[model samples]
Target: MLDDFDRVLAQARRGSPEAFQSLHGDLVRPVAAYLRNKGVTEIEDVTSDVFLAVFTGLGGFTGGQAAFRSWVFTIAHHRIADHWRREARAPALVELTLDDDGGTTPAAEHHALDALGTARVHELLDTLTPDQREVLLLRIVADLTLEQTAEVLGKPAGAVKSLQHRGLAALRKIVEPEGVSP
Candidate 1:
């Protein structure tokens, strides 16, 4: 599967619908979930916009899978920012649910504890500043490295690191109120 990297990218860049769908399969869930974390109301819509921008710009894109992933996420970040600018307010916290994009909850096999844990993560993330929240989500949620996260945020690596450190500390404070000293 990995060996077809060049073929997939070349075809997708050339406007091959099937290749685009193939790329979407790898990225859709994670990207939508990231937008949801950003409090994006129309997650699927924004996600589609992200992919559209990517496909349109693919002719100019260079590099392999890692670079492609970073570029797509950078587009996602920009789209979320645009959404906020239109709303004229920072993203607000919503009641985090354990529902999937299909708006369905997990089945009986999944524990209530798991759902609560998912809600707990969103709750904790909600406490951080927007910059910190974005950094944490880019790193932990999007699974981007520090460099990639920095690129997405248009911040220096040091700034990204600082935000991540502060974000983690804040989460620790909430999770372990007294045990860990500041």
Candidate 2:
């Protein structure tokens, strides 16, 4: 993916739709998944906004894949914050309930999510404290560095490190059986 990105990112920056599509294929799921974990209900809408920002600002950006990744995620993180702010300002709209024949059923969603292994991941992640989950998601899922995750969470690098270490230990204990050894 990194190797393909050199030429692809260059082409995307130049307004090549194919190149941008390729880049989107690589990034969209992770970005959307991260947003979903952060409780963004309209994941696709926010993901689209993030990509629009990325493409619009792509020409001015100069970086390798890691930098591009961080940049993209930075945009996504800000979008989540914006979503939160909007929600805080908005009044209650409607309540949604799941139905078997409805657009999105719990069983259907669960089955679909299971195919992506997201349900299991969610199950494991649900056991974590919010701070531990955030650190793990930013570092492991988003592929952010300790410094990057720290910046995102407004914590010191040492704090991020400790969170990560403790998060992993908790996950290990939860996932592993009593007879299993590390």
Candidate 3:
């Protein structure tokens, strides 16, 4: 899959519509999932924006598949931050309440989230700083090597490694409260 991604990115760089489509198809779900985890309820709209940013910025790209994915995610991070800022400045909306008739409400979203590990894992991920979260996601979820993650983030490999270490340590604290074995 990684090799295919490299080929698709190379072809897409040369302006192959089919290759770009293939790449988009491959990436949309994961990217959307990442955004959704970031608290963006409008996943479809944000996903569209992310892809549009990717397409527009593709010409300036100078790395391989890993780099490309990182770059796309970088754009997404910025977009999420922008959305946060906008929301912060906006006036608060009135809260609406609905009466509950003692019927069992649906199971918590956390219940179904174990497919990605425990809901606790996702909660721990949210505890990481943005830089740490980005490096961890790109490395673990996207399966990019440290060097590749660095390339995508436009950072040195050492920095990516440091971030990954810190992020993993944080996750370990949550996952293994007894403490990590040496």
Give lDDT tens digits, candidate 1, residues 126-166: 99999999999989878888998988888999999999999
Model 1 stretches with alpha carbons more than 4 Å out: 1-3, 87-119, 177-182
Rank candidates by TM-score, best first.
1, 2, 3
Score candidate 1 by lDDT: 0.85
Of 1 and 3, which scores higher on lDDT? 1
Go through the candidates in order and give each one's C-alpha lDDT: 0.85, 0.85, 0.77
Best-fitting candidate, scored by TM-score: 1
User: How far in Å is the alpha carbon of 39 misplaced in model 3?
Assistant: 2.9
List ranges where model 3 is wrong by over 4 Å.
Answer: 2-17, 92-119, 126-130, 152-154, 178-182
Q: What does candidate 3's lDDT look like per residue over 89-114, in tens digits?
A: 98878778669767776667655765
Q: How many clashes in candidate 3?
A: 0
- Could you give me the TM-score of model 1 versus the true structure? 0.76
Which pairs, if any, clash in model 1? Answer: none
Candidate 3: what lDDT?
0.77
Alpha-carbon RMSD to native, per candidate? 6.2, 4.3, 4.7
Which clashing pairs does model 2 show? none
